[model samples]
Target: MSLLKGKQLTHYYFNTSNYTKALENISLSVEEGAFISLLGPSGCGKTTLLSILAGIIEPTFGKVTLNEKNVTETQSEMGYMLQQDYLFPWKKIIDNVLIGPKIRKTLDNQTIEKAKQLLKDIGLSSVIDAYPSSLSGGMRQRVALARTLITDPSLLLLDEPFSALDFQTKLKLEDLVSALLKQYHKTSILVTHDIGEAIAMSDQIYVMNANPGRIHQQFEVPIELRQLSPFDARKHAKYQHLFDRIWEELNQLESTSIG
Candidate 1:
């Protein structure tokens, strides 16, 4: 079943006397516990779509529904993880994880305990007291992930969360994130420019076209990719075939836009 749905999403930006359409009649549905990715070039409105779904931005002519209710009107049930870890330099790791509950005024003993348990579950128990500055990029992102999960969000919006990490670190975190999302049964939507990352992590990928961005095509990742770790998924025989297919589609979009 679809846990989240966007219908005829259209968004625009105004600058003094001129307006630009960032998204155009985009529509999508994310099944429960499924991982979905928005893949396209830099101007493809991927992040704009994500913000609209998160209720951070209102679409010019569409609506986002979560569980049949308008997401903008409902109480927040979404977690957003960005490209940067965004942890406060002065806050300890444990404290950072509790920020969500603290902001929502639900930071009680139970929430605190959950935060601690989440840190432990994410393999950061040994560094609970360490500050963000003391951790590696990957570790900080892990802490950020824990912070997002501590809130027990019904949906997750990931905007290139692993983009800043090293290639090796990105692969490791991809595996970790894929495992955690499945284990928690959280439906997630990731916005990424990396075709491989999208293929490895997503159950469905929406390839978008730029210049008034709209969905170009949709691809269902192979079932075998879902069973393998992200690194192993990269080596699967179908991986290259799928990658080349997406690459061609994206290239076509680019070439068409230029022409």
Candidate 2:
């Protein structure tokens, strides 16, 4: 069943003298516990669409529903992860993960224990008392992921959370994230410009077009590819074919824009 659905989503921006349409008739549905990716070039409204789904912004001409309820009314069940880890430099790793529950006034003894266990699960138990500056880029992102999971969100919105890491680190985190999402049974939507990342991680991919961004096509990753780790998935023969197909579609969109 669809855990989240957007119906004919359209969004616009208005200035004093001009109005711009950021998204046009974009529609998508994410199945429960499934991983989906929005793949597009910059300015394709991938992030915009994600923000709408998160209830950070309202669409001009559509509605977003999470489990048949409007997202705007049930925002607390969603978690958003961004490209930057955004951990405070002065805060200890454990403290950083506690920020959410603390802000919500729900950081009881049980919640604190759960946060510590999350750190342990993400391989950051030893660094619980260490500040963000003491950790490597990959470790910090892991802490960030722990923070996101601390809330027990049903819907996770990932906005290129691994983009800033090194390629090897990115691969490792991709494996970690995919595993954790499946383990937790969380429905996720990722926005990325990386083709291989999308193919390696997503169960489903929605290719988007720019200039009033809209869905161009949707592809389901082969079941065999989904069985392999993200790094190994790259070496699969079918991987290249899917990559080339998406590359061609994106190139065509670019050419049309230029012309």
- Model 2 spans with C-alpha error above 4 angstroms: none
lDDT of 1 by residue, 1-259 (tens): 7899999999999999999999999999998888999999998899999999999999999999999999887546899999999999989999999988888899999988888888888789999999999999999999999999999999999999999999999999999988899899899999999999999998899999998999999999999997888889999998889999999999999999999
Best of the candidates, TM-score = 1
lDDT of 2 by residue, 24-133 (tens): 99888998988899999999999999999999999999999999999999877898899999998888889899988887788999998999899998888999999999
Question: How many residue pairs collide in each prediction?
Answer: 0, 0
Q: Report per-prediction Cα RMSD to one decimal.
A: 1.0, 1.1
